[model samples]
Target: MDLIEVLQHRYTAKAYNPDRRLPEEIVAQLMAALRFSPSSVNAQPWHFIVAGDEAGKARVAKGAAGPFAYNAPKILNASHVVLLCARTTLPPEHLQAVLDQEQADGRFAGEEAREGQRKTRAGYVALHEQAGDLGMWTQKQAYIALGFLLLAAGTLGVDATPMEGFDAEALDGAFGLTDKGLAPAVIVALGYHSDADFNAKLPKSRLADSVVFSRA
Candidate 1:
């Protein structure tokens, strides 16, 4: 489908067909889309936890206990669940790693371009650091990847549901995210929708463009 049709057809899949598992090739494409997601200054301060096995999905579902119980089944039934995590801090080394990869990938024309990128990226990082919400800023970048994943899933005819209802702290503890300097931001459950998914038949709703956007 074209981009507009894909957007029009896609909706949050509240229930997944447990009998239908996603193919490895489709999963690879979704991961590639996420890997190429844009970030501020290309800091790329995020990590993704992909849960495909029963044990792994169960572990992730545990994070939805108590007040978030509604999300547990969705996570468990989906072919795969992805935990989007953001780094607690964007350390200097992280930026250096991105720069190193850029150089190796020939993204820089020369030493001058490489140095320029380093300086510019560092400046943006410092700016965010001074704002005193570096983690929040990082989480915002993770959401960009989330958006990319959702769109890619739609294009691939994969049903998905974006979730922010889980316990972040609990998920972090369950998956040892803190020890890895990562914190859960959101989740995306992916697969084919179940026959009983009422949301699949609901009409899409959105505010009119006149109210949602404006020309200066």
Candidate 2:
């Protein structure tokens, strides 16, 4: 299907068929999409934890307990769940690591090019740090990846539900993300909708283009 058609039909599935599992090939494509997601200055300050089995999903479901109990079924029943995480801090070592990977990937023409790339990335990181929004900035980058994953799922005829109603603190503790310099930003459930999914029968609703867009 075309992009327009996919966008028009895609909806957040409220219930999933637990028996359904995504093909390994499709899961690989989705992982690639997340890995290559664009971020400002190519900061790539994000990590993804994907749960594809019963036990793995149960661990991710821990965050959905108590006040977030409503979302537990979605996580548990879905074929897979992805926990999107953002870096808690962007230190100099992380910047160096990015630069080193770029160089190893042949992204530089020479040492001069490598140095220039390093300086540019550092400048942006410093700016965010000075603004006292480094953490927010990283989280925004992770959301960009989430958007990519959602669109990729739609194109692949997969039902995806991007959820943020879980308890982040609980999730971090469950995953020991803090010590790893990471924090949970969002979670997404992927699978085929079940017969009980009432949302499948609903019409899509959104504001008119005129109200949401500007000519300027």
Candidate 3:
């Protein structure tokens, strides 16, 4: 399909056919698309809880029941459901390597790196940030992943509904992720559409073109 046509036609499916399933290879390709998503200092902060089994999917479905819980069977019918969990802590090795690279490139230099550290710390002490350098970077990384997943699903002709309409702690525990230190930020339900679930009824909302512009 044409690139614009694919995106132009995208929409979130509210209901789904319980028998639909996505191939493993297709899921892998979707993740491959995620690899290209940009992140601050390349500290990819997201980790996924692949919940495809009946019990696991049921657990998530029950926990997320607002307008989305009704379609639990439809999503369960998919080959798998992905729980987008983000580690609250920066992966140590990734940070070490990034800091090492910056140190080597002399971009931060020794004293400048020291100053950056000081400023970052100040951001926390003065305004309440934690985990120092990792705090800001980690938050930025999650958003990058979210955007990537949206476009990747679109590219594959798969319908997805990205949601933030549930409890995070409840989801974390249901997925047994507290031990893993990952927090659930978004819940996206994915699969092939059942015609009624198509974007036919939804129009994209936007700010007026005149209401948007560049500073430069």
List the candidates' TM-scores in order: 0.98, 0.98, 0.72
lDDT per residue (tens digit) for residues 158-193 in model 3? 777766676665676677777776777666777776
Tens digit of lDDT per residue, candidate 1, span 124-160? 8888889998888999999999999999999999999
Off by over 4 Å in 1: none
- For 30-122, candidate 2 gives per-residue lDDT tens digits of 999999999999989999999999999999999998899999999999999999999988889998999999988999999999999889999
lDDT of every predicted structure (CA atoms): 0.93, 0.94, 0.65
Q: Which candidate tops lDDT?
A: 2
Query: 80 in model 2: Cα distance from truth in Å?
Result: 0.6
Better of 2 and 3 by TM-score: 2
Error of 1 at 143 (Å): 0.7
Give candidate 3 misplaced runs (Cα > 4 Å). 66-79, 91-137
lDDT score, candidate 2: 0.94
User: Could you tell me the lDDT of residue 177 within candidate 3?
Assistant: 71
Which 10 consecutive residues of model 1 have the lowest summed lDDT? Answer: 166-175
How well does candidate 2 score on lDDT at residue 213?
A: 98
